[model samples]
Target: MEYLKRFLKSIGWIARGVDLLVAPLTIISGLSFRAMKFIGVKKFPINNSLFHKIGFFPIVNHYYEPQFDFKGYSQKIRHFEGIDFNAEAQLTLLHSFEYKQELDALPNVKSDGGGYFFNNGSFESGDAECYFSLIRKFKPKKIIEVGSGYSTLMAVEAIKLNRMEGEENMCTITCIEPYEMQWLSDIEVELLTQKVEDADLGLFEKLEAGDILFIDSSHIIRPEGDVLFEIFEILPRLRSGVLIHFHDIFTPLNYPEKWLKEEFRMWNEQYLLEAFLSHNAKFEVVLALSYLTIYHKQEVCDTFPVYAKDAGKTLGSFWIRRL
Candidate 1:
């Protein structure tokens, strides 16, 4: 059965290559599909595989965007229906100013004297700064970061600073990453070299009110996928007041146009989050970094003059407190 599965997979790749080689023909078929829809055809007889083969996937995506209204979703959560997301962002912005000096003091791993290094890869824009600031401010007793990397380094630095200040209840950090980096191995935090979905579910249940559940997931949801497991199982089991951080979540807007058309990053984790938060009052928005960067551009620039140049752009680091 395994050999048959592999054989089929190889054949599938060959078929995909053939489809791409005849892309012009496929695109013509896609145009026909669009015409069929225009003629009031309720549904096409073809499935997604056929759509891909006929080069209609991108067209379908462009025309029939996700029904979830991301702008309205952001607006609803930002308003004070239960928690004032804007006010929380404002408060977080204020606290961020205090941490600049300390953040600037952390030794840069790649370079010297620039504080924590940030770029397009790993942690970048204001997300790195925001994570560092939040860790210092909240002082979570325990931090369980799911997809770890540069953020782990930042969190470790924050914990170190907390200990240096002689805080009695210093936070302990743990990282769960299946594909570990060389730098990740050197970090002092407890490392679980496995997927979060496969890790013991009880690890999340142990989290109390003042902990952090940091998630930088695969961003793709499938049957029995990690994103589904975390959303359905881990989130519901966490205690109230626990801080939750989701990476690459650009709310108030859908995934970037460039990402979809150019980069082809078909990430839908934000959509899942939108669905989860729609009518549920169990969670409250704390700080939406992308939302703040776009909507509260001036404030973000003022708060971190060092990152002022990148203030106009969006960064994907969202924080929510369990209610």
Candidate 2:
């Protein structure tokens, strides 16, 4: 019996020693996880030019601001330490990430109504600078945008400012919408070109590359969602130098309903991402205006369901050039 007691005591000591060793590692791992809660895991294959460079936290301004919920990957990244690898990750997590250059002024375009549409709000001076800068850099010959009315007006102003001329600086802008056309008296279009009924949109095949397309159709209807998906599928028709922009993402939330009465009138961002990604398009959220989303032909990912539970299919407002 005494020998058994000694054996038991030996086992207890060994167990205690093992716990002592394991505790610190376990605690360390737990702490690591907590740290990751704010940052997130470092991932490879950033997949998008906007997300590729690992520095300067893309869309970090309002992401971790604490006053509001960034939501999506940025929101998730703000909550974790490392694994939250989306654009929301701050410099603390990726101190080495590169901060890209931001454009400052419009090359040639000006807002017609005296205000630059930013974050769904009309912005002037510095606020509009970012929009102009985005226009200056993209230099799209073909422009496609989604949503309607106000956004279209703003885009018209941008196109006039950004369009460049070589032997012939030719550009075309297409806005896909189910609503009636509004007055574009603020901007000038040498030729209004042809009109495709909401049903005959299949004829967009002739747009070619270097043309821009915008999708601001309908944000509240399932058919509009389907239209967006169809447009994305036909992106191979775009010519080089194509530029596309998505409206409504200027609002923080991915859904159009989350927007205030004014914001509700615009398109949503979630659908834009889905259209781009599912069609293998590439794009970026211009820091000056996340609302001013950009796209080209590349391996983009689909993110349509990020906002609306009932979101139909992916639709986008970014530009694509046919290769």
Candidate 3:
């Protein structure tokens, strides 16, 4: 009987063209369970464990809309004891640096609904701003970013800010953009137009204690090449003091019922992190604020604040550093 109701409710959501078909099923199940109380059915007869494995539809329906929430933040993360990463402080680092002049110089698009958003390819304003914040805070001697886009510009601006402040380091930014987004080349960073795995990592020979490595490339190479190499192969080449950042560390809304799908294998950012954790190495999460995670060497993790703040935002990035 419960399955019949769930199936009918799922059809309703499916008929409505909603992305989360299971949402209606969960809602109907919850309501039916309550009504059963009057009829004296003390226990929920259906095996709902399977539905729970499908995705986060029930939580979204019962809680807030598909927006920022702690449920999203706490979903797939593995937290350790220490000072949580402070999202506000990290955001301040981005805000403190001057980017308005550069952002204003770029082209803008008037919104059909109301205000204007920039034409930069697929960059979320807050996300890009937070990336810039990391650059300002780390003040790394070298920044090697995979899958370059608007982040290249943020790195450039951060370096420019460092120079303006006379920080003495004079950071070098290198972008490995496989698609060769032409606009990114216009920036001041050293742009590599090849896939990340193919890029010459000879730059690592000169990598210093404060260098940073950012990974946001395709999870798996299309016809050939494995993206995991970016972590397994390239990471060993990097020295101990360097910081490693992984973007998109949470399951997407449309995640399939089975976790082992090829799409999940290729694009699910959490897979790579979990795989890395399985390896016998010391990697510490320094900052897990919003969707951005920054990690340093195990010894250095103790130095960072464990407190993370984003008010209420989640995009699922994680930080892991080799010890």
Candidate 4:
């Protein structure tokens, strides 16, 4: 309490007119120092991982990143372990506010008379914010999102916000969601209010070149888990420059549970990443928050192996172990 009071007092002093003259300059100086330090810390860019169209923001999700020198930060990250706020803490209060902003903008349309929420299946406010911001930053001509709920609607919310702010030059977005629970009619209703047209039905099966994908679906199947990606094997058709996103890559929503123990297994990002590398490479984890994984295929490899049956199409699965 005393430390908080002191911090608050310090903030008040910073806000006061007496300090106001020096505050902005001092703040700028502090930011400059931090920027220098961040650059100084092993200055490794994701040049190798960036060839792919994927765009990730690691600072937002606070997910475990193999980079950021985990061994060094492990002590620091664990130092304030129990505190609500840590230097490593990714999402900010601003993220929560953004989520509410998305929620508030949504229209209450009912296909079956219940209040319906719309968003890309990524339902968390912060996760949605992370995705939407990446979309703006990446400016992908083709985009893909994996999991969604009302959060996909939040993306549409972001589109509305972008148009209101006038970003006509931004790239087109296509989100692949397997669950048909939301029903196209409700989605159409929601899009109608936003001046956004209906979603493309071909989103799940295939996409032409210059597209990106979000893999928020599932690594495993469950009664509760509707979308299954492990068995789906849908990564081949995406073009070389496609941006791929994976949600829940760091965390599990009660998987390996009583109901789905037979169907569940531990997931390793390394395995999945290596698998992705079979076809594409050059990547970096931009957002470490919410177990987020974003990668852009720098170039589609020649070894993506054409299936025996359909010589024109790629094989079903590319395993990290086999290749």
Best by TM-score: 1
Pairs with backbone N, CA or C atoms under 3 Å apart (clashes), candidate 1: none
lDDT of each: 0.74, 0.39, 0.55, 0.37
Please count the clashing residue pairs in each candidate, in the order shown: 0, 56, 14, 48
In model 4, what lDDT does residue 58 have?
24
Q: How close is candidate 4 to the true structure, as a TM-score?
A: 0.38
Pick by TM-score: 1 or 2, better one:
1
Off by over 4 Å in 3: 1-121, 221-226, 251-266, 278-281, 290-313
Ranking by lDDT: 1, 3, 2, 4
| Candidate 4 runs further than 4 Å off | 1-122, 170-178, 188-211, 221-237, 251-281, 290-323
lDDT of 2 by residue, 120-238 (tens): 33333222332333444455555544434545555566566554334244455555444444444344432232232233445455554334455444444244454455455545454
Q: Which ten residues in a row have the lowest lDDT in candidate 2?
A: 296-305
Q: Which candidate's lDDT is highest?
A: 1
* Residue 80 lDDT, candidate 4, scale 0-100: 18
Against the true structure, what is every candidate's RMSD? 7.1, 22.8, 13.0, 22.2
Ranking of candidates on TM-score, top first: 1, 3, 2, 4
